[model samples]
Target: MTVTASARAASPLLDLVRPARPTHVVDVGANPIDGDPPYRGMLAAGLCRVTGFEPQPDALDELKRRKGPHETYLPDALGDGGTHTLHVAATSGMTSLFRPDTNRLGLFNGFSEWGRVREEVQISTRRLDDVEEVDAFDLLKIDIQGAELMVFEGGRRKLAEAVAVHTEVSFVPLYENQPVFGDVDQELRGQGFIPHAFAAVKRWPIAPVVFGGDFRQARHQLLEADVVYVRDFGHPESMTDEQLKQLALVAHHVYDSTDLAYHCLSQLSLRGLAVPDAPNRFLAVLGSANRT
Candidate 1:
Protein backbone atom coordinates (compact mmCIF):
# COMPACT_ATOMS: atom_id res chain seq x y z
CA MET A 1 0.00 0.00 0.00
CA THR A 2 1.12 3.52 -0.67
CA VAL A 3 0.41 6.87 0.95
CA THR A 4 -2.54 8.38 -0.88
CA ALA A 5 -1.38 10.88 -3.43
CA SER A 6 -3.42 14.12 -3.45
CA ALA A 7 -3.11 17.77 -4.37
CA ARG A 8 -2.32 18.63 -0.77
CA ALA A 9 -0.15 15.62 -0.05
CA ALA A 10 1.15 16.73 3.35
CA SER A 11 -2.57 16.68 4.19
CA PRO A 12 -4.56 14.81 1.58
CA LEU A 13 -7.71 13.40 3.09
CA LEU A 14 -8.09 16.51 5.20
CA ASP A 15 -9.65 18.70 2.53
CA LEU A 16 -12.03 15.97 1.47
CA VAL A 17 -12.70 15.02 5.07
CA ARG A 18 -13.16 18.64 6.10
CA PRO A 19 -12.63 21.46 3.61
CA ALA A 20 -12.69 24.38 6.02
CA ARG A 21 -9.27 24.19 7.64
CA PRO A 22 -7.31 27.41 7.05
CA THR A 23 -4.56 26.96 4.47
CA HIS A 24 -2.92 30.40 4.47
CA VAL A 25 0.49 30.14 6.14
CA VAL A 26 3.49 32.35 6.89
CA ASP A 27 6.95 30.74 6.87
CA VAL A 28 9.49 32.59 9.12
CA GLY A 29 12.81 30.86 8.38
CA ALA A 30 12.43 30.13 4.71
CA ASN A 31 15.84 29.12 3.34
CA PRO A 32 16.17 29.63 -0.43
CA ILE A 33 15.18 26.46 -2.24
CA ASP A 34 15.95 24.48 0.87
CA GLY A 35 13.80 21.84 2.57
CA ASP A 36 10.30 21.45 1.09
CA PRO A 37 10.58 24.52 -1.14
CA PRO A 38 8.72 25.93 1.89
CA TYR A 39 5.76 27.57 0.18
CA ARG A 40 5.48 26.26 -3.35
CA GLY A 41 2.38 24.07 -3.81
CA MET A 42 0.43 25.55 -0.98
CA LEU A 43 0.10 28.63 -3.17
CA ALA A 44 -1.04 26.45 -6.04
CA ALA A 45 -3.93 24.88 -4.15
CA GLY A 46 -5.61 28.28 -3.79
CA LEU A 47 -5.32 27.44 -0.11
CA CYS A 48 -2.18 29.49 0.49
CA ARG A 49 -0.59 32.90 0.43
CA VAL A 50 2.60 33.40 2.42
CA THR A 51 5.24 35.91 3.45
CA GLY A 52 8.56 34.08 3.65
CA PHE A 53 11.49 35.75 5.44
CA GLU A 54 15.16 34.78 5.24
CA PRO A 55 18.34 36.70 6.24
CA GLN A 56 21.12 35.04 4.25
CA PRO A 57 21.88 36.92 1.03
CA ASP A 58 22.26 33.80 -1.09
CA ALA A 59 19.18 32.18 0.35
CA LEU A 60 17.21 35.37 -0.01
CA ASP A 61 18.16 35.55 -3.67
CA GLU A 62 17.15 31.96 -4.18
CA LEU A 63 13.83 32.66 -2.54
CA LYS A 64 13.28 35.47 -5.01
CA ARG A 65 14.22 33.25 -7.93
CA ARG A 66 11.84 30.55 -6.78
CA LYS A 67 8.85 32.71 -5.82
CA GLY A 68 5.47 32.81 -7.61
CA PRO A 69 1.94 34.13 -7.14
CA HIS A 70 0.44 34.42 -3.63
CA GLU A 71 3.93 34.42 -2.09
CA THR A 72 5.97 37.42 -0.92
CA TYR A 73 9.59 37.61 0.23
CA LEU A 74 11.32 39.64 2.90
CA PRO A 75 15.10 39.85 3.35
CA ASP A 76 14.90 40.73 7.02
CA ALA A 77 15.03 38.62 10.16
CA LEU A 78 11.93 38.57 12.39
CA GLY A 79 12.72 40.22 15.70
CA ASP A 80 12.16 43.40 17.74
CA GLY A 81 12.28 46.55 15.65
CA GLY A 82 15.96 47.41 15.29
CA THR A 83 19.01 46.95 13.15
CA HIS A 84 21.52 44.19 13.90
CA THR A 85 24.25 42.36 12.08
CA LEU A 86 24.05 38.60 11.92
CA HIS A 87 27.07 36.33 12.03
CA VAL A 88 26.35 34.59 8.73
CA ALA A 89 27.22 30.87 8.81
CA ALA A 90 29.73 29.76 6.15
CA THR A 91 27.32 27.39 4.44
CA SER A 92 23.79 28.06 3.20
CA GLY A 93 21.99 25.57 5.42
CA MET A 94 24.34 26.49 8.21
CA THR A 95 23.74 30.20 7.73
CA SER A 96 21.80 31.54 10.71
CA LEU A 97 20.86 34.88 12.26
CA PHE A 98 22.99 34.22 15.34
CA ARG A 99 26.54 33.50 16.56
CA PRO A 100 28.50 30.42 15.45
CA ASP A 101 28.75 28.73 18.83
CA THR A 102 25.05 28.13 18.63
CA ASN A 103 25.60 25.86 15.64
CA ARG A 104 27.82 23.64 17.77
CA LEU A 105 24.88 22.89 20.04
CA GLY A 106 22.67 21.55 17.25
CA LEU A 107 22.79 17.86 16.35
CA PHE A 108 24.55 18.51 13.08
CA ASN A 109 28.26 19.50 13.21
CA GLY A 110 28.81 20.03 9.49
CA PHE A 111 28.53 23.81 9.94
CA SER A 112 31.55 23.82 12.28
CA GLU A 113 33.59 22.24 9.49
CA TRP A 114 32.41 24.68 6.77
CA GLY A 115 34.76 27.15 8.51
CA ARG A 116 34.24 30.73 7.39
CA VAL A 117 33.62 32.86 10.47
CA ARG A 118 32.87 36.46 9.64
CA GLU A 119 31.92 39.69 11.39
CA GLU A 120 28.29 40.69 11.85
CA VAL A 121 26.57 41.75 8.65
CA GLN A 122 24.01 44.55 9.02
CA ILE A 123 20.35 43.44 8.92
CA SER A 124 17.07 45.16 9.76
CA THR A 125 14.70 43.68 12.34
CA ARG A 126 11.02 44.25 13.14
CA ARG A 127 8.95 43.82 16.28
CA LEU A 128 5.50 42.27 16.06
CA ASP A 129 4.21 45.07 18.23
CA ASP A 130 5.11 47.43 15.43
CA VAL A 131 3.03 45.35 13.06
CA GLU A 132 -0.11 47.43 12.67
CA GLU A 133 -2.01 44.78 10.77
CA VAL A 134 -2.16 41.06 10.13
CA ASP A 135 -5.54 40.18 8.58
CA ALA A 136 -5.38 36.45 9.34
CA PHE A 137 -3.00 33.50 9.26
CA ASP A 138 -3.86 29.82 9.59
CA LEU A 139 -0.30 28.83 10.36
CA LEU A 140 2.98 30.61 11.14
CA LYS A 141 6.27 28.65 10.92
CA ILE A 142 9.35 30.01 12.70
CA ASP A 143 12.68 28.27 12.02
CA ILE A 144 15.04 31.20 12.47
CA GLN A 145 17.66 28.99 14.13
CA GLY A 146 18.45 30.20 17.69
CA ALA A 147 16.91 33.63 17.30
CA GLU A 148 13.35 32.28 17.30
CA LEU A 149 12.72 33.80 20.70
CA MET A 150 13.71 37.25 19.53
CA VAL A 151 11.19 36.91 16.72
CA PHE A 152 8.61 35.66 19.22
CA GLU A 153 9.31 38.61 21.48
CA GLY A 154 8.83 41.06 18.65
CA GLY A 155 5.76 39.38 17.21
CA ARG A 156 3.69 39.30 20.38
CA ARG A 157 0.71 40.89 18.63
CA LYS A 158 1.11 38.86 15.45
CA LEU A 159 1.35 35.69 17.51
CA ALA A 160 -2.07 36.46 18.83
CA GLU A 161 -3.27 37.14 15.30
CA ALA A 162 -2.30 33.72 13.96
CA VAL A 163 -4.33 30.54 14.44
CA ALA A 164 -1.40 28.14 14.71
CA VAL A 165 2.36 28.38 15.11
CA HIS A 166 5.16 26.07 14.02
CA THR A 167 8.60 26.78 15.43
CA GLU A 168 11.69 24.57 15.56
CA VAL A 169 12.99 23.69 19.01
CA SER A 170 16.28 22.06 19.96
CA PHE A 171 16.38 20.54 23.44
CA VAL A 172 20.15 20.88 23.66
CA PRO A 173 21.91 24.21 23.29
CA LEU A 174 22.70 24.71 19.61
CA TYR A 175 23.75 28.31 20.07
CA GLU A 176 25.97 29.61 22.87
CA ASN A 177 23.24 31.85 24.28
CA GLN A 178 19.99 30.55 22.86
CA PRO A 179 17.03 29.58 25.00
CA VAL A 180 16.23 25.91 25.57
CA PHE A 181 12.88 24.14 25.00
CA GLY A 182 11.60 25.26 28.38
CA ASP A 183 12.17 28.92 27.57
CA VAL A 184 10.61 28.65 24.12
CA ASP A 185 7.56 26.80 25.45
CA GLN A 186 7.03 29.36 28.17
CA GLU A 187 7.25 32.14 25.64
CA LEU A 188 4.74 30.38 23.41
CA ARG A 189 2.31 29.80 26.26
CA GLY A 190 2.73 33.39 27.42
CA GLN A 191 1.29 34.44 24.11
CA GLY A 192 -1.61 31.96 24.46
CA PHE A 193 -0.14 29.32 22.17
CA ILE A 194 -0.32 25.68 23.21
CA PRO A 195 1.93 22.82 22.11
CA HIS A 196 -0.55 21.53 19.59
CA ALA A 197 1.57 18.77 18.01
CA PHE A 198 5.01 17.57 16.89
CA ALA A 199 6.59 16.61 13.59
CA ALA A 200 9.60 14.29 13.39
CA VAL A 201 12.90 15.30 11.75
CA LYS A 202 12.87 14.84 8.00
CA ARG A 203 14.13 16.71 4.99
CA TRP A 204 10.88 15.97 3.16
CA PRO A 205 7.93 13.58 3.20
CA ILE A 206 9.91 11.19 1.00
CA ALA A 207 12.71 10.91 3.55
CA PRO A 208 11.45 8.59 6.27
CA VAL A 209 13.10 8.13 9.64
CA VAL A 210 14.50 4.60 9.70
CA PHE A 211 15.90 5.00 13.18
CA GLY A 212 14.11 5.75 16.45
CA GLY A 213 13.20 9.23 17.71
CA ASP A 214 16.01 11.52 16.62
CA PHE A 215 14.88 14.38 18.89
CA ARG A 216 15.05 12.02 21.85
CA GLN A 217 18.47 10.72 20.81
CA ALA A 218 20.43 13.25 18.69
CA ARG A 219 23.24 14.80 20.74
CA HIS A 220 23.60 18.42 19.56
CA GLN A 221 20.93 18.87 16.95
CA LEU A 222 20.21 22.29 15.41
CA LEU A 223 16.48 21.55 15.52
CA GLU A 224 14.45 18.48 15.87
CA ALA A 225 11.37 18.42 13.68
CA ASP A 226 9.23 21.55 13.96
CA VAL A 227 7.02 21.89 17.05
CA VAL A 228 3.51 23.16 16.29
CA TYR A 229 1.34 25.36 18.51
CA VAL A 230 -2.32 26.27 18.10
CA ARG A 231 -3.83 29.54 19.21
CA ASP A 232 -6.74 29.28 21.64
CA PHE A 233 -8.49 32.02 19.60
CA GLY A 234 -10.67 32.75 22.66
CA HIS A 235 -12.42 29.38 22.51
CA PRO A 236 -9.88 26.78 23.47
CA GLU A 237 -12.39 24.08 24.20
CA SER A 238 -14.78 24.72 21.33
CA MET A 239 -14.51 22.40 18.29
CA THR A 240 -16.76 20.02 16.38
CA ASP A 241 -15.87 16.34 16.34
CA GLU A 242 -15.06 16.40 12.63
CA GLN A 243 -12.81 19.42 13.13
CA LEU A 244 -11.15 17.54 15.96
CA LYS A 245 -10.55 14.58 13.65
CA GLN A 246 -9.13 16.84 10.98
CA LEU A 247 -6.78 18.36 13.55
CA ALA A 248 -5.76 14.89 14.68
CA LEU A 249 -4.88 14.10 11.07
CA VAL A 250 -2.61 17.14 11.01
CA ALA A 251 -1.04 16.13 14.34
CA HIS A 252 -0.38 12.66 12.92
CA HIS A 253 1.48 14.26 10.02
CA VAL A 254 3.32 16.67 12.28
CA TYR A 255 4.41 14.03 14.79
CA ASP A 256 3.74 11.24 12.34
CA SER A 257 5.20 8.61 14.63
CA THR A 258 3.71 9.63 17.95
CA ASP A 259 0.60 8.11 19.58
CA LEU A 260 -2.88 8.80 18.14
CA ALA A 261 -4.29 10.43 21.26
CA TYR A 262 -2.08 13.50 20.90
CA HIS A 263 -2.90 13.63 17.21
CA CYS A 264 -6.59 13.82 18.14
CA LEU A 265 -6.42 16.35 20.95
CA SER A 266 -4.32 18.81 18.98
CA GLN A 267 -7.27 19.91 16.87
CA LEU A 268 -9.20 21.33 19.80
CA SER A 269 -9.96 24.58 17.99
CA LEU A 270 -11.21 23.46 14.60
CA ARG A 271 -14.32 25.43 13.60
CA GLY A 272 -16.98 23.44 11.70
CA LEU A 273 -17.13 19.65 11.89
CA ALA A 274 -18.76 16.93 13.95
CA VAL A 275 -16.86 14.95 16.58
CA PRO A 276 -17.05 11.29 15.70
CA ASP A 277 -18.16 9.19 18.67
CA ALA A 278 -15.47 6.54 18.40
CA PRO A 279 -12.31 8.39 17.33
CA ASN A 280 -10.58 5.11 16.49
CA ARG A 281 -13.13 4.21 13.80
CA PHE A 282 -11.54 6.46 11.19
CA LEU A 283 -8.07 5.38 12.26
CA ALA A 284 -8.99 1.72 11.90
CA VAL A 285 -10.39 2.35 8.45
CA LEU A 286 -7.25 4.10 7.31
CA GLY A 287 -5.03 1.54 8.96
CA SER A 288 -6.81 -1.39 7.37
CA ALA A 289 -6.75 0.29 3.97
CA ASN A 290 -2.99 0.87 4.28
CA ARG A 291 -2.36 -2.85 4.75
CA THR A 292 -4.04 -3.76 1.48
Candidate 2:
Protein backbone atom coordinates (compact mmCIF):
# COMPACT_ATOMS: atom_id res chain seq x y z
CA MET A 1 0.00 0.00 0.00
CA THR A 2 1.24 3.50 -0.87
CA VAL A 3 1.37 6.22 1.78
CA THR A 4 -0.56 9.29 0.69
CA ALA A 5 1.25 12.68 0.57
CA SER A 6 -1.09 14.37 3.04
CA ALA A 7 -0.96 11.47 5.49
CA ARG A 8 2.82 11.58 5.21
CA ALA A 9 2.65 15.27 6.05
CA ALA A 10 0.46 14.71 9.13
CA SER A 11 2.22 15.00 12.47
CA PRO A 12 1.54 15.69 16.14
CA LEU A 13 1.34 19.44 15.61
CA LEU A 14 -0.61 19.39 12.33
CA ASP A 15 -2.69 16.46 11.11
CA LEU A 16 -3.19 16.71 7.38
CA VAL A 17 -6.42 14.77 7.15
CA ARG A 18 -8.16 15.65 3.90
CA PRO A 19 -11.21 17.22 5.53
CA ALA A 20 -10.09 18.04 9.01
CA ARG A 21 -11.33 21.49 9.95
CA PRO A 22 -8.75 24.14 9.09
CA THR A 23 -7.27 26.16 11.92
CA HIS A 24 -8.85 29.61 12.03
CA VAL A 25 -7.15 32.98 12.57
CA VAL A 26 -8.90 36.34 12.91
CA ASP A 27 -6.98 39.60 12.39
CA VAL A 28 -8.32 42.99 13.44
CA GLY A 29 -7.04 46.35 12.20
CA ALA A 30 -5.04 44.32 9.71
CA ASN A 31 -2.61 45.94 7.34
CA PRO A 32 -1.34 42.88 5.51
CA ILE A 33 1.91 44.46 4.35
CA ASP A 34 2.89 46.66 7.28
CA GLY A 35 2.93 44.47 10.38
CA ASP A 36 3.88 41.07 8.83
CA PRO A 37 0.87 39.30 10.35
CA PRO A 38 1.73 35.84 11.66
CA TYR A 39 -1.50 34.44 10.27
CA ARG A 40 0.04 34.79 6.82
CA GLY A 41 2.75 32.39 7.87
CA MET A 42 0.18 29.96 9.32
CA LEU A 43 -1.90 30.09 6.16
CA ALA A 44 1.17 29.32 4.06
CA ALA A 45 1.74 26.20 6.12
CA GLY A 46 -1.50 24.94 4.48
CA LEU A 47 -4.86 23.80 5.85
CA CYS A 48 -5.65 27.05 7.65
CA ARG A 49 -7.99 30.00 7.37
CA VAL A 50 -7.43 33.74 7.91
CA THR A 51 -9.99 36.54 8.17
CA GLY A 52 -8.64 40.08 8.28
CA PHE A 53 -10.44 43.34 9.06
CA GLU A 54 -9.04 46.57 7.68
CA PRO A 55 -11.17 49.74 7.52
CA GLN A 56 -9.10 51.62 4.99
CA PRO A 57 -10.81 51.35 1.62
CA ASP A 58 -7.61 51.37 -0.43
CA ALA A 59 -5.95 48.69 1.60
CA LEU A 60 -9.16 46.68 1.63
CA ASP A 61 -9.30 46.60 -2.18
CA GLU A 62 -5.74 45.32 -2.42
CA LEU A 63 -6.34 42.77 0.32
CA LYS A 64 -9.47 41.51 -1.40
CA ARG A 65 -7.54 41.08 -4.62
CA ARG A 66 -4.71 39.22 -2.91
CA LYS A 67 -6.91 37.02 -0.69
CA GLY A 68 -6.29 33.29 -1.02
CA PRO A 69 -8.79 30.46 -1.29
CA HIS A 70 -8.93 30.11 2.50
CA GLU A 71 -8.53 33.80 3.32
CA THR A 72 -11.02 36.67 3.63
CA TYR A 73 -10.74 40.44 3.86
CA LEU A 74 -13.44 42.61 5.38
CA PRO A 75 -13.65 46.36 4.87
CA ASP A 76 -14.93 47.26 8.29
CA ALA A 77 -13.55 48.45 11.59
CA LEU A 78 -13.74 46.27 14.69
CA GLY A 79 -15.21 48.05 17.70
CA ASP A 80 -18.26 48.17 20.00
CA GLY A 81 -20.70 49.18 17.27
CA GLY A 82 -20.76 52.95 17.41
CA THR A 83 -19.49 56.06 15.69
CA HIS A 84 -15.86 57.08 16.27
CA THR A 85 -13.40 59.44 14.71
CA LEU A 86 -10.31 57.84 13.13
CA HIS A 87 -7.34 60.18 13.44
CA VAL A 88 -5.49 59.62 10.19
CA ALA A 89 -1.84 60.49 10.66
CA ALA A 90 0.75 61.86 8.24
CA THR A 91 2.46 58.57 8.90
CA SER A 92 -0.28 56.03 8.28
CA GLY A 93 0.98 53.64 10.97
CA MET A 94 -0.08 56.11 13.66
CA THR A 95 -3.72 56.18 12.55
CA SER A 96 -6.03 55.28 15.41
CA LEU A 97 -9.37 55.90 17.06
CA PHE A 98 -7.70 58.09 19.69
CA ARG A 99 -6.00 61.40 19.00
CA PRO A 100 -2.26 61.71 19.38
CA ASP A 101 -0.89 63.78 22.30
CA THR A 102 0.79 66.78 20.64
CA ASN A 103 2.81 67.56 23.76
CA ARG A 104 4.29 64.09 23.87
CA LEU A 105 4.84 64.04 20.11
CA GLY A 106 6.89 67.27 20.26
CA LEU A 107 9.31 65.75 22.76
CA PHE A 108 10.44 62.94 20.45
CA ASN A 109 12.59 63.45 17.34
CA GLY A 110 10.86 62.49 14.03
CA PHE A 111 7.91 61.31 16.16
CA SER A 112 6.08 64.56 15.45
CA GLU A 113 5.78 63.51 11.80
CA TRP A 114 4.53 60.15 12.91
CA GLY A 115 1.85 61.61 15.18
CA ARG A 116 0.85 64.48 12.90
CA VAL A 117 -2.81 64.01 12.06
CA ARG A 118 -3.39 64.31 8.33
CA GLU A 119 -7.16 63.96 8.55
CA GLU A 120 -10.04 62.99 10.83
CA VAL A 121 -12.79 60.79 9.44
CA GLN A 122 -15.88 59.72 11.32
CA ILE A 123 -16.67 56.04 10.85
CA SER A 124 -19.13 53.57 12.34
CA THR A 125 -17.91 50.26 13.70
CA ARG A 126 -19.36 46.93 14.83
CA ARG A 127 -18.42 44.11 17.14
CA LEU A 128 -16.97 40.92 15.67
CA ASP A 129 -19.82 39.07 17.39
CA ASP A 130 -22.25 40.86 15.12
CA VAL A 131 -20.77 38.95 12.19
CA GLU A 132 -22.04 35.41 12.04
CA GLU A 133 -18.97 34.23 10.15
CA VAL A 134 -16.71 34.55 13.21
CA ASP A 135 -18.05 31.58 15.12
CA ALA A 136 -14.69 30.43 16.50
CA PHE A 137 -10.94 30.66 15.94
CA ASP A 138 -7.65 29.19 17.13
CA LEU A 139 -5.66 32.42 17.15
CA LEU A 140 -6.53 36.11 17.16
CA LYS A 141 -4.00 38.72 15.95
CA ILE A 142 -4.87 42.39 16.46
CA ASP A 143 -3.00 45.59 15.55
CA ILE A 144 -5.37 48.53 15.66
CA GLN A 145 -2.94 51.21 16.71
CA GLY A 146 -3.89 51.98 20.35
CA ALA A 147 -7.37 50.43 20.33
CA GLU A 148 -6.39 46.90 21.35
CA LEU A 149 -8.76 47.03 24.35
CA MET A 150 -11.73 48.09 22.26
CA VAL A 151 -11.26 45.23 19.80
CA PHE A 152 -11.27 42.75 22.64
CA GLU A 153 -14.28 44.44 24.24
CA GLY A 154 -16.28 44.07 21.04
CA GLY A 155 -15.06 40.60 20.18
CA ARG A 156 -15.40 39.03 23.60
CA ARG A 157 -17.63 36.26 22.24
CA LYS A 158 -15.21 35.31 19.50
CA LEU A 159 -12.26 35.84 21.83
CA ALA A 160 -13.61 33.20 24.19
CA GLU A 161 -13.08 30.62 21.46
CA ALA A 162 -9.49 31.66 20.74
CA VAL A 163 -6.65 29.53 22.14
CA ALA A 164 -3.88 32.11 21.64
CA VAL A 165 -3.35 35.78 20.83
CA HIS A 166 -0.72 38.21 19.46
CA THR A 167 -1.24 41.93 19.73
CA GLU A 168 0.70 45.18 19.87
CA VAL A 169 1.04 46.81 23.28
CA SER A 170 2.30 50.21 24.40
CA PHE A 171 4.28 50.74 27.57
CA VAL A 172 3.43 54.44 27.52
CA PRO A 173 0.33 55.98 26.03
CA LEU A 174 0.86 57.52 22.60
CA TYR A 175 -2.74 58.50 22.06
CA GLU A 176 -4.93 60.54 24.35
CA ASN A 177 -6.72 58.36 26.92
CA GLN A 178 -5.24 55.18 25.47
CA PRO A 179 -4.80 52.31 27.87
CA VAL A 180 -1.22 51.13 28.38
CA PHE A 181 0.10 47.57 28.54
CA GLY A 182 -1.12 47.16 32.12
CA ASP A 183 -4.76 47.48 31.08
CA VAL A 184 -4.25 45.04 28.21
CA ASP A 185 -2.43 42.54 30.44
CA GLN A 186 -5.18 42.68 33.05
CA GLU A 187 -7.86 42.36 30.40
CA LEU A 188 -6.32 39.27 28.77
CA ARG A 189 -5.63 37.72 32.15
CA GLY A 190 -9.28 38.23 33.06
CA GLN A 191 -10.15 36.45 29.81
CA GLY A 192 -8.08 33.37 30.78
CA PHE A 193 -4.87 34.09 28.86
CA ILE A 194 -1.36 34.15 30.30
CA PRO A 195 1.45 36.17 28.77
CA HIS A 196 3.84 33.72 27.13
CA ALA A 197 6.36 35.73 25.09
CA PHE A 198 7.25 39.21 23.90
CA ALA A 199 8.12 40.15 20.29
CA ALA A 200 9.10 43.39 18.50
CA VAL A 201 10.17 45.27 21.61
CA LYS A 202 10.48 48.96 20.63
CA ARG A 203 12.24 51.45 22.87
CA TRP A 204 12.49 55.22 22.92
CA PRO A 205 14.96 57.01 25.15
CA ILE A 206 13.92 59.98 27.32
CA ALA A 207 16.83 62.00 25.96
CA PRO A 208 17.73 60.83 22.46
CA VAL A 209 19.98 63.81 21.68
CA VAL A 210 22.54 62.60 24.21
CA PHE A 211 23.46 59.59 22.00
CA GLY A 212 23.58 61.48 18.71
CA GLY A 213 19.74 61.63 18.78
CA ASP A 214 19.46 58.09 17.50
CA PHE A 215 16.65 56.42 19.46
CA ARG A 216 17.90 52.97 18.48
CA GLN A 217 21.07 53.39 20.59
CA ALA A 218 19.10 54.60 23.59
CA ARG A 219 17.04 51.73 24.91
CA HIS A 220 16.14 53.68 28.05
CA GLN A 221 12.39 53.66 27.53
CA LEU A 222 10.27 50.63 26.61
CA LEU A 223 7.87 52.14 24.13
CA GLU A 224 5.93 49.36 22.45
CA ALA A 225 5.97 45.59 22.07
CA ASP A 226 4.01 42.70 20.61
CA VAL A 227 3.00 40.16 23.22
CA VAL A 228 1.97 36.54 22.76
CA TYR A 229 -0.60 35.13 25.12
CA VAL A 230 -1.61 31.53 25.45
CA ARG A 231 -4.70 30.00 26.95
CA ASP A 232 -4.28 27.04 29.31
CA PHE A 233 -0.48 27.13 29.29
CA GLY A 234 -0.33 26.30 33.01
CA HIS A 235 -2.64 23.34 32.36
CA PRO A 236 -2.16 21.94 28.89
CA GLU A 237 -4.12 18.86 29.84
CA SER A 238 -7.23 21.02 29.95
CA MET A 239 -7.13 21.82 26.25
CA THR A 240 -8.86 19.73 23.62
CA ASP A 241 -6.74 17.81 21.10
CA GLU A 242 -7.54 20.36 18.37
CA GLN A 243 -6.65 23.30 20.63
CA LEU A 244 -3.34 21.69 21.47
CA LYS A 245 -2.52 21.31 17.79
CA GLN A 246 -3.31 24.96 17.11
CA LEU A 247 -1.24 26.15 20.04
CA ALA A 248 1.63 23.96 18.94
CA LEU A 249 1.59 25.45 15.47
CA VAL A 250 1.60 29.08 16.65
CA ALA A 251 4.24 28.47 19.29
CA HIS A 252 6.48 26.61 16.86
CA HIS A 253 6.47 29.16 14.05
CA VAL A 254 5.67 32.53 15.63
CA TYR A 255 7.03 32.36 19.17
CA ASP A 256 9.89 29.83 18.79
CA SER A 257 8.49 28.12 21.87
CA THR A 258 9.98 24.71 21.41
CA ASP A 259 9.26 23.55 24.96
CA LEU A 260 5.62 24.60 24.91
CA ALA A 261 5.10 22.86 21.60
CA TYR A 262 6.74 19.75 22.99
CA HIS A 263 4.47 19.93 26.02
CA CYS A 264 1.41 20.04 23.78
CA LEU A 265 2.71 17.06 21.85
CA SER A 266 3.24 15.15 25.07
CA GLN A 267 -0.31 15.87 26.17
CA LEU A 268 -1.67 14.81 22.80
CA SER A 269 0.37 11.64 23.01
CA LEU A 270 -1.09 10.86 26.43
CA ARG A 271 -4.57 11.24 24.94
CA GLY A 272 -3.54 9.11 21.93
CA LEU A 273 -4.41 11.98 19.65
CA ALA A 274 -0.88 12.17 18.26
CA VAL A 275 1.74 9.64 17.23
CA PRO A 276 4.19 8.37 19.86
CA ASP A 277 7.26 9.70 17.97
CA ALA A 278 5.86 13.24 17.50
CA PRO A 279 7.67 14.71 20.47
CA ASN A 280 11.02 13.29 19.37
CA ARG A 281 10.64 14.67 15.86
CA PHE A 282 9.57 18.03 17.28
CA LEU A 283 12.65 18.27 19.48
CA ALA A 284 14.92 17.30 16.60
CA VAL A 285 13.52 20.04 14.40
CA LEU A 286 13.89 22.59 17.18
CA GLY A 287 17.47 21.48 17.74
CA SER A 288 18.26 21.73 14.04
CA ALA A 289 16.92 25.28 13.89
CA ASN A 290 18.98 26.32 16.89
CA ARG A 291 22.18 24.91 15.40
CA THR A 292 21.85 27.14 12.34
Query: Which number leads on lDDT?
Result: 2
Off by over 4 Å in 1: 1-22, 32-34, 37-41, 102-109, 132-134, 202-225, 232-292
Find the number of clashing residue pairs for candidate 1: 19
List runs of model 2 lying over 4 Å from the truth. Answer: 1-12, 16-20, 33-35, 207-217, 285-292
- Candidate 1: worst 10 consecutive residues by lDDT? 202-211
Models 1 onward score TM values of: 0.66, 0.88
Clashes of 2: 0
Local accuracy of candidate 1 as per-residue lDDT tens digits, 1-292: 1223444554534533553544456777787434574334445554456677776767788788877766777776778777776766565554555566734533243334543455567787877556444444556777776778888887776556555677778675545676777888999888777776664453311112223544233332234466777654245465345334434443444334234434444343233342443334445655776898
Writing each residue's lDDT as its tens digit, candidate 2 over 1-292 gives 1223552263334541112356778888777656567665656656467888899887788778877777788888888788999999987788899999987776665678788998999999888889776767888888888888987877777777778989899987888999899999999998889998886787775633646655546546787898989986777756666777777776766666879888877777777777787788777755675698
How accurate locally is residue 194 in candidate 2, as Cα lDDT from 0 to 100?
Answer: 94
